[model samples]
Target: MKVITTSTQTWQAKLAGLLLLCTPLINACTDPSDIGLKLDPEANRIGVFYAEIPLSAYLVATDSLNTTNAGVLVAGGDISDYFGETEATAYSRMAFSTSATKPENEAILDSAKFSLEIGSLTAEDLDETKTFAAHKLTEPILDTAYYNFDQLGFEETPFASGSFMLEENSDTVVFMNIDEALATDLFTKIKDEDPVFDDIFSFRDYFPGFALKGSPSQQTTLHVNPGTNTGFKLYYRNSEEDTISSVYTIYTSSSRHFNGVTNNPTGTPTEIVTEKNKAYDVGALVGSKALLGHLVKLDMEPLSNFLDTLDNVIFNRATLSMGPTENFPDSKMPIQGLIQYFTDDSNKILRREEDNAPYSVQLGTVLQTMTDEDGNVVPAVTSGGTNPLVFNTSEYIYGPANTREGITSYVDALYRTDVMRTDLLLYPAVVSTSGTSIITSSSITRSLREYVVNQNSITLKIYYSKLR
Candidate 1:
């Protein structure tokens, strides 16, 4: 994804003025020559320090997610170590706008089938077989918005039921034959030119929609693209002597369709993270045992005290480092993560924008490496190993004190607040391009982590000049 680099000029000017006020104190330090001190221009002028503080985190559940315009429709069931079991069912109201004349009175309806095109699949879904049951919806799927938790009423008896076996490395379409009696009814109505078949509105009154649900025994989930290549097709013949057969199709549209997902955290890691009252255990082990999101709070009071102990200081760079525990393995670790700050109980900080263009700092993944006793370099995962998590905190710390009038906008005021503690959320890095202010389901996932503790809990490495 392309990064946006636009910012607010007014915010930058305010930050720059604050930095100017701190310059005089830095220049007031005593000269080295007056003290008869012979100091090398580039030798040991910068001081470095490291500190680790305790962390706290918790999992938050967001059930009422609007999935009406989501790109892909998801269906099936899966059990996650971190989130317990989740089952998803998709409902679509299909329609057809026709101008062709009705078929002959003697036309015979042969068959009707419902088909869905499979999109992408996860590694866990390889060679999977999922059983699905299609039920007739009791209520109309209105053109209005719907959420993931919305429960639409449907008939108790399924009109069609079948199982689809997923092939390895193949994107195959699944088809299920509809009840023959239902097909005959639709054929007769269309052939007889019934008033119900005249328009889409009347057509829906006779046939509301179908609700496709995954069987409870499913082990893996599947992505079903109902908007594009999904629909119901009916085959018929005008006469027995005629050679070719005719078909009528009805397609599912995105306007009145919804995907319902239910997350059951009964015995998963999410249960532990949500039920526990104390600080959370975040790292690879905790992540593997159960997928969980983290709420990391930075203890900034100690950092402020450390800065007060020094005189005439000019900060150069600050790096925050954290990694998996010594026993946590790298194979099970999540490849990417997202970090953001909370604004209130329900809101979160967002990228700064100017004239609709967004500007924000991008976070990258860092791996920790160390030399073993045998002198071979490898990932630091043993006792006395360093954590792999490292983030540059310079912009969040010193940037506010040296902001440029126009050049420094979003980055400068990132951490201008004087709060002693700041809470940051950590989750699997799911990408979004919609530019919405609130965090949606598209940006949340069930990833796990367990950071190093005690002496190696979480550390800040700061390098600064004494301004002698």
Candidate 2:
């Protein structure tokens, strides 16, 4: 694939001027009522074409996801009868103030409690009962590194266990009493060592951490606020006659913690297995199992060939459309999808922050619904209908070669086949905010069929003004 650059700066400047002239004419005459102004299509020299190309796609596992400063701690179990099962567990290293002094020998250890502030619950989970257990971590929670698939060692004995029905709770906070024996052991250690209670480093050495695991059940997962309303509190008395007892809280900070999520495709007919080959046609069956990470890789050779024949062309729009073979139920369909550059080195999805140019595009709300003649609403899958996923590649395709210098540089890179390659990756959308790390939900499962493009398929509509 190559782009030819033969025009000079003066010719490129004239083309830019022509583009401004065409913009107002196109926008003003778009409405039927305001179509009095006559516009010459031949003089404008605008053209449109349905770009035909081959696409290679497949599914890949996303393991060892980074979960630093994710704000919410995830824990729950969800099973998809058609796909597979998913379970999530949260681990955190609690921190206490280093400046705080240890309790005196006269202080009598009372009770201990652990609480978590629930953020959200899925609609399906509200009716069912779920049980959760806390275990004593055997190793320290490293502040520097951790992953979503990490399996940290923990004691077999549970610190506390509790069950709650989602419907019965209106409050956002969930509380559980820690075992008295565990509290007594901690009290004894604190009194004997008289250790500094302030720093996280020393605190973790004495008390490694805790792992909150949910019982395996096909229910909704939970998102709990780790920054606030999550901690371990130990209550004690200075003396037998003391009126007010002293309380110390170890907060579950964002320092060192991760949510471990495992997706098990045991019972599903289309079991998620490792793909030995990367370049393979994504069939209808494979595309329907998108939750298993089935992806479609678009080859950019067709687009590059189209650009090579044009000179002093200003691209208005270039879009790629993809759709499922059959209309899927709303519950089974994924609301969003992601398009990114695939690399073989790592399985984790790269964020916009990591790239120089925006290499990822989020296709929001793919399914379009319409009411039938009988007043029943359903997914749109008719001829000449909108695609489930559409990507506007105008900026990515044209923006690089907009200027004369950019065109020359782009053409040189294209010929080398080093800088200008048209292979793109499609996957399930994962969110990454300004200050927080990327977050992938374990509860949602998106499944759809492969999109096939032909001459009648939704074409790449490009509006441009060719320099005379």
Candidate 3:
């Protein structure tokens, strides 16, 4: 995408004078920069310039995300015409609770079961039922992290299985009966104080973990929380004459669990962005899709080139305003907002030059009301206007314009250097700031792919102090 150069000069000076006057007032009667002191806009016959530059957006596959110890664990299948078929398998290591005690001697094993604490659900249709199976993992979950695309080996036969209709508020737990024989063996080992039960690490070698796999169903995925209360259980009678029963439970380790996702993009819009073609333009096809390992990459080469034409320029405010496509489906809630980060060539987020941490921002969300042709006021979404996703880019263009010298070590590298370029990746996420600040993982898609970038409404609006 390129800036409409035809109107560049005409639009540059439209708000030049007005912004110069307002800048001083906007800064709360403080000088924004020394550049304003040196080159007065009115005295030098210069003003603040503005230009709208178009940007190229691609719905590209995101780099594999680290799913280790992810706050939310998802399982089952999520099928969509827009995203294709996405399946998730959860792997978790089971450990004996610190207070876990052995069952009584001569205890008769009754039964065993595995259960999942369902946190939430993302489904195309709730009427459809999904069958989930719990298979013993062949290997232990590593202390190291696991990626969303990572798959661990598990037993072919499932020891337990259950079927149920997925719901967000209705169901709390999904339970499956475990094999009696296997349950009895586990009961005996605990009663006999087997060496494997000596420690959590030792026990993990004998019994690795459980891999919860779901049968393909409608687009429905369960966010399961296999915390301390959810896992394997053994029920047994203490003795022949004892009416009372004893229970021993193995809890899942929170720090040692992760979800593996498999996305088959066959016969879907995402198919175009396969391994060979990582980035595909969202020209007409409902804009760009997110999650299912997908992201939107914005290239601002045209805007960078346009910025080169001006000299002695101090950019006051550079805002990139954009929003979701107007034709977004009504079935799914629109993504609240997007998180932006600079990306490397591999689409991995780059670390900031100052702190070595990735620079990210929750773009400002704005609802701009406008009058239609018939003189009726309506929300932008109603009139197909751009719902504001305004991102401040002044610091990225140069240094902080409000600073004393307006010079910083972290500035100027991004836009000027090809090595560290100006490409940005946008992910569907919501940042919460209640007590503790929390950012939702971009890997968890909610199974709703309606939040696509509005290509037509995207504009890089630059506000610059045009000093000659």
Quantify all predictions' global Cα lDDT against the true fold: 0.47, 0.48, 0.58
Model 2: ten consecutive residues of lowest lDDT:
395-404
Q: Tens digits of per-residue lDDT for model 3 on 1-468?
A: 222111112334434454443223121112212212333344435455445566677777766666777665667765666667778887888877656767877888877878778776655555666777888889778889787779899999998988887655454876789887778778888888888888888888888887877754555566677675578878788888878777788877554788787877798766777662266764644343333567777776665566455556665556565653453222234444455666646676665344465544322132323344667542222111111132223211111112221211112222333333357776655433333222344434433333544466666655555556
Model 2 spans with C-alpha error above 4 angstroms? 1-57, 62-72, 81-83, 101-110, 120-123, 142-144, 165-171, 188-193, 196-202, 236-246, 267-272, 275-282, 285-313, 320-339, 342-419, 426-468
Winner on TM-score (1 vs 3)? 3
Clashing pairs in 3: 79-219
lDDT of 1 by residue, 62-171 (tens): 33446664555556655655446667777777777577545699987777887777764332444555677788899998878877667688999887777766653357
Tell me the tens digit of each residue's lDDT in model 2 across 220-320: 55567775468777788878998787886667866467666666767663364545224443233333223223344444454455556555544433344
Instruction: Order the candidate numbers by lDDT, best to worst.
Output: 3, 2, 1
Worst 10 residues of 3 by lDDT: 395-404
Model 2 / residue 337 / CA error / Å: 7.0
Task: Enumerate residue pairs that collide in model 2.
Answer: 97-198, 98-198, 98-199, 288-448
RMSD of each: 14.9, 14.1, 12.4
TM-score of each: 0.60, 0.58, 0.67
Each candidate's number of clashing pairs is 12, 4, 1
> Model 1 — which ten-residue stretch has the worst lDDT?
398-407
